[model samples]
Target: MDIVTANQLKTKGISVIESKLADKKEIIISVRGKEKYVVMAIEQYNYLRECELDAALNETRADYQNNKFITESVEDHIKRITK
Candidate 1:
């Protein structure tokens, strides 16, 4: 991963990020010498979000297949979960 200091980012702005990201997928932003943030292209962020949703969908399917869900009225579900 490429590393950019807070000072560098402060002075250089998005151009620095754009240049660094030209050939890289992501870069780390360090603040006070500690890794603090990550910068990535929007496509990468969206892809990750889609992957997260897909994982959740798969987990929900597995739970259903294992008979781990409940069927109840809306009021009953609300009461049951609230308790």
Candidate 2:
């Protein structure tokens, strides 16, 4: 992880992005001495996003397998709620 000030990020946006892509690194952007944002390569971002989705999906599947799922479609569930 690399840290960059917000002003530096604004001025050198392209280089920062290129560096992260070339090195598979992440940049933490700071604003007023506090961490504000993360800069990562698109591929890395996508990979992490997919991993989060997979983890959520696995949790959902496990819950369903344990008979913890609600057996209702959206429409039926809504109708039941409105009744």
Candidate 3:
């Protein structure tokens, strides 16, 4: 993680963004000398997000494969709920 002042970021915004994206690095933008926002490549963010979702899906599939899933039918579930 790299930290950049708001002024510096505003002055060299495009170059900073390009460098971060090329290196797949994250930059923390600060305002009033306090950390405010993060900047990252869109592709990197999307790839990481997709990886997380894929991991969750794989875990769910593993649980289901291991018979750790609910086996209630819709009608039975509705009847039990109504009762």
Order by TM-score, highest first: 1, 2, 3
TM per candidate comes to 0.92, 0.76, 0.65
**Model 2 regions more than 4 Å off:** 73-76, 79-83
Runs in model 1 deviating more than 4 A are none
Q: Give one digit per residue, the lDDT tens place, for model 2 in 6-53.
A: 787789877866775576558788899999988887787899999999
Which scores higher on lDDT, 2 or 3? 3
Write candidate 1's Cα lDDT for 13-79 as tens digits.
9999999999999999999999999999999999999999999999999999999999999999999
**List of clashing residue pairs for candidate 1:** none
Ranked candidates, highest lDDT first: 1, 3, 2
For model 1 the TM-score comes to: 0.92
